[model samples]
Target: MRYLPIDNQLFVQNRQRLAPLLKSKSLVVVNANDIMPTNADGTMVFRQNNDLFYLTGVDQEETRLVLFPEHPDPKFREVLFLRETSELIEIWEGHKLTKAEAEQVTGIPQKQIYWTHQFEQIFGQMVFEAEFIYLNTNEHTRAGVEVQTRDARYIDAFRQKYPLHHLERLAPLMHYLRAIKQPQELPLIQTAIDITDKMFRRLLGFIKPGVWEYEIEAEMMHEFLRNRSRGAAYTPIIASGANACVLHYIDNSQQCQDGDVILLDIGAEYANYNADMTRSIPVNGRFTARQRAVYDAVLRVMKEATQMLRPGNLWDEYHREVGKVMESELIGLGLLDRTEVANQDPDAPLYKKYFMHGTSHFLGLDVHDVGNKYRRMEPGMVFTVEPGIYIREEKLGIRLENNVLITESGNIDLMANIPLEADEIEEMMN
Candidate 1:
């Protein structure tokens, strides 16, 4: 791993917390994500399953975690199966985790560590003893699963093997546990945000008219890679001019124009934890009068929306309130009038024309991280406060974002040190 080693206590505590939530006599199983295949003989870089990583800091392929708290044998209760290393394998693919190394990294006893080949025999015994089996699968609200994952394959095979064993979805329990950030996880996220901050600041000096949008993206990747980030948490969106009006613009093929604005929706990932940030800047380092108005409107909305991210606030209600704030700012910017807003359908506000996407989303292991949106906000929850206005007709788009942690007292902006104010951005650029 390019990132530094994390303390194992975080994973230990995560397992301890999740154990109580499962049904009695349950056998919990989480498999690592498969090393995905590409064109012939090639494979994409491996990414560990977030749940598997959360439960046991093992970031490798063909790994499995079994949590059978009620097992007759204490040693079998919490077993971690790793792909055993060999001389030939080492020569071909480098060294894999040793038993002692895995034990130290995961805080599991050395005796409980075993080779992946032993999983079928050990898991079979546990399945016979346990009444329920908890299986992990991707259940993110926005997930579109076209490819069959390792977990999916396991579910199909396991059902055929033991049809009588009561199966339960582990996603809900995992989601609930992961929703609240543990104290140790905060530093990893902060590290990612800090890397992103460095990249953004570097771009300020590099961005100018005549530069290609991809050039700006390359600068971001360069900074992130040097600062221990595994490239972007997601595909970096380097949208310039009218391209910025497209929400998911990532073509990054056009040259930046002097009067145009660039919407950079990018982030850095450190130790698997992610930071989601978006910032809009003038291509020529100075916002025109009209551009400044739209930018300020979005900035005001972003600030007001951030303040509403405190504990006890409901997500839907908070977004509705943010919409009202945005509506007012849009009116002030002459994008929408009082009469238009008054007659507009409450369910489908006229503001959708200029400002469409949600103002905030949970940010963590995944860029659009998982958390129950219907539930009220709580302390330890981190969200990205991104509000924007896209004026396609005027070829102007402005978005300002920061990662914020919800606290009991209020909220803490993780990107607070990064430039946000128009004057500050202008000053930095100049």
Candidate 2:
């Protein structure tokens, strides 16, 4: 792992929280993500499944965690299975976790840890004792994964092996638990945001009228690596000028022009926790009057949305309020007529022409972290407040984003120290 080790207490506490939510005699299973293959004899980088990591603090492949809180035997109540290592395998792929190492890393009892090959026999004995089987899967509302996951394969195998066993979805339970950050998780996220802040400061001094968009991307990668981040939390959007108006623009092939603005949507990933941030800067280190105006408007919306990410706030209602705020700003910018806005189809707000996306989304383990949108915001929940104004006709787009943490009293902006104001960014660039 590129990131530092996280305390196993966090996972212990997470399992404790989940145990009570499960029905009696239920056995929860979480599998590590498969190491995906690319082309001939090539494989993509391995990323441990977030849910598996959350439950066991084991960031390795071919691993499984089973939680049977009501098991007749204490050892089987919480067991971890690891891939058995061989001399040839060790030489080929470095060290796999030893039984003792797994116990130390995951807080699992060493005696309870067994090799992956023994799972069939051990799990067979445990499954018959449990009345219900809970299996994990990617249930993110926006997820569109085409490839089957290790968990999916396990689900198929279990169904065929025990056709009469009552199976249950574990995603909702996981989403509910992972949505709120634990005390230990906050520092990891803060570290990611801190790394991104340093990179942005460095980037300000490097951006010039002639620099290629890819050059800026290179700078971002360099900073992230040195700071121990595992690159960007998601694919970065390094869009310049008209490219910025294409919401998810990632083709950073164009050259920056003196008067054009570049929209940077990037963040660093640390220890599986993530940061999500966005900023729009002038190529020549000075925004045009129009650019500054649009930038300020988006900043205003971002700030307002950040404040709304507090306890008791519903996700759907919060976005609706942010839309109204954007509508007011668009009218002031002469992009929307007040009469036209008021008369526009309530189903489709007129402000969407300039600001089409939601003002905020849950942020943490994943860039778009998992949480029940309908559930009210609570303390320890982190969110990304991003508001943008895209004007394709004028070849301009302005977006401002920050990570926010909802606390008992109010909320804290994780990226507050990072440059956000147009004047501050301009000053730093100059």
Candidate 3:
């Protein structure tokens, strides 16, 4: 791994907390993500399964984590099955983890090194002993199909082998635990944000009338790589002008124009933790008065929404409150009439016509990080406060986002150093 090692205590505590949630005599299993293939001999870069990484801190492929808290043998309680490295693999792909190394990295004392071929025999032995199995799967609402994942294949095979055992979904428990960032995870996310801030500042001088959108993406990548990040946390949306209206716009091919605004929703990933940041700024040195009005309104709504992210606040209620805040901002921007809002459908508000997406989501491991929307805010919970107004007809989209960590007092803005105010942004650009 290019990134520095994360403290194993984070993973240890994560497993400790989750162990009680499992049924007695049950074993919890987590598999690393498949090193997905493209065409021919080509393959996409490997991304470790967030759940597997969360539990074991093992970032390699063909690795499996078995947590049998109720095992008769203490060594079997938490076993890490790794891809036993061979001389050939070392010559080609460099060294894979040794048993001692995996133990050190994960702080799980018991390690059973195995090849991919031995998985069935080893796993089958555990299945016969356990009454229930906690199988990990991607249950995130935003997850969409593209290719078959390792977890998906594991489920199909596991059911065929042990159809009688009660299979429980591990995603819900993982979503709950991973959503709440541990103290050790916070610094890694902060490092990502710091790198992202540096990249954004670099773009201020680099972005101008003639720069292509992809060039901006390249600039951010340069900064990320230099700062020890894997790269952009997600596909960067370097949308300029009308393209900003497309929420997931990532073509990044168009040339930025003088009067146009570029919506940049990008962040760097340090360790496995991520930072999701969005900033819309003028291509020129300054925002037009009209643009400034809408930008500031979105900024105001973002600031207010962040304040509501303290402990005990429900995620759904917080979003509803954010909608009202956005409704007011839209009304202030003349996009909504006060009377219209009063008469609008409760299910589909007038504000949706202009400001479409939700104001925030849990931010951490994944960009749209893992958290139940139904879950109440806790002090350790981290989220993104991103509220925007996109008017395709007007060819304008303004979004300002920052990472906020819930605290005892209220919440701390992790991206507090990143320039957000219109004056600060413009001054940085100039």
Q: How high is the CA lDDT of each candidate model?
A: 0.93, 0.92, 0.89
Clashing pairs in 3: none
Q: Tens-digit lDDT track for model 3 on 1-430?
A: 8888878898889899999988899998889998877999999999999898888899999999888888877767887788878899999999898888887789987445555667777766676789989988788899897777888898898888778989999999899888888889899889999999999999988999999999999999999999999898998999999999999898999999999999999999988788899999999988999999999999899989989989998988988899999999888888889998999899998899888889888888898898888777889988899999999888999999999999999999999999899999899888
Off by over 4 Å in 3: 110-112
lDDT for 174 in candidate 2 is 89
- Tens digits of lDDT, candidate 2, 1-430: 7788788898888999999999989999999999999999999999989999988888899999999999998989998999999999999999999999898888888999999999988888788899999998899999998999899999999889899989999999989999999999999999999999999999999999999999999999999999998799989999999999999988889999999999999999999889999999999999988999899888888878888888998999999999999999999898999999979998899998899998888888899999999999999999999999999899999898899999999999999999989999999999
Instruction: Report the CA-based lDDT of candidate 2 relative to the real structure.
Output: 0.92
Candidate order by lDDT, decreasing, is 1, 2, 3
lDDT of 2 at 66: 92
Please report the TM-score between candidate 3 and the true structure: 0.97
lDDT of 3 at 58: 90
Instruction: Assess every candidate by TM-score.
Output: 0.99, 0.99, 0.97
